[model samples]
Target: MENKEVIEPEILKQVAKILKVPVQAIKNFSEEAAVNIISNTFSDESVAYTEYYKYTINPFEKWVDAMDKNEQLFKELLKSEREKIELPEKLLNEKKGNK
Candidate 1:
């Protein structure tokens, strides 16, 4: 029987789910080499991209860092929106009277 091959994105997503790590952490070596590279990276965590002569990055770390930076921006946006909402005193009184 011929052996079946696993593809890159599928292996990456599955490993991320199983390891609770992140899809970005896994790099696809190639369409055909995906399974082998995944097994090596998971076991050693030191697999290098020979073409680049450096270790590949897990993308999730960069994503997390970016989100962290955006937190302050989001907080400022929410605060600005809240400050811009001006409730007239008459409207406030009317709402209280209705209640």
Candidate 2:
């Protein structure tokens, strides 16, 4: 018997499902065709061209911008809290003055 690379049937089925082809097609592929599939799947330019990578290239940028906006909002909230604390203190001081 000739030596052949033995891929799991389940793995071939998943690959076929992903490729939208039948498992038998994968099983029947020639070595060159198999190489072509692998090259097409992960070519050097694939990362730059894949739709998912387009959004992920700078994933942290959105997070950092959101964090900055939150920081600004937190500063405003802190200022409002300081104002609220001062309001009661001012009212108490005025009551003392009236005594």
Report the CA-based lDDT of candidate 1 relative to the real structure: 0.72
Residue-level lDDT tens digits of model 2 in 63-82: 89999999999999999999
RMSD of each: 14.8, 6.7
| Model 1: per-residue Cα lDDT over 15-89, one tens digit each | 779988767654433555877777778767476546766557879998998898899889999898776665565
For model 2, the local distance difference test gives 0.82
- Candidate 1, residue 35: the lDDT equals 76
User: How does each model score on TM-score?
Assistant: 0.30, 0.42
Predicted structure with the largest lDDT when compared to the true one:
2
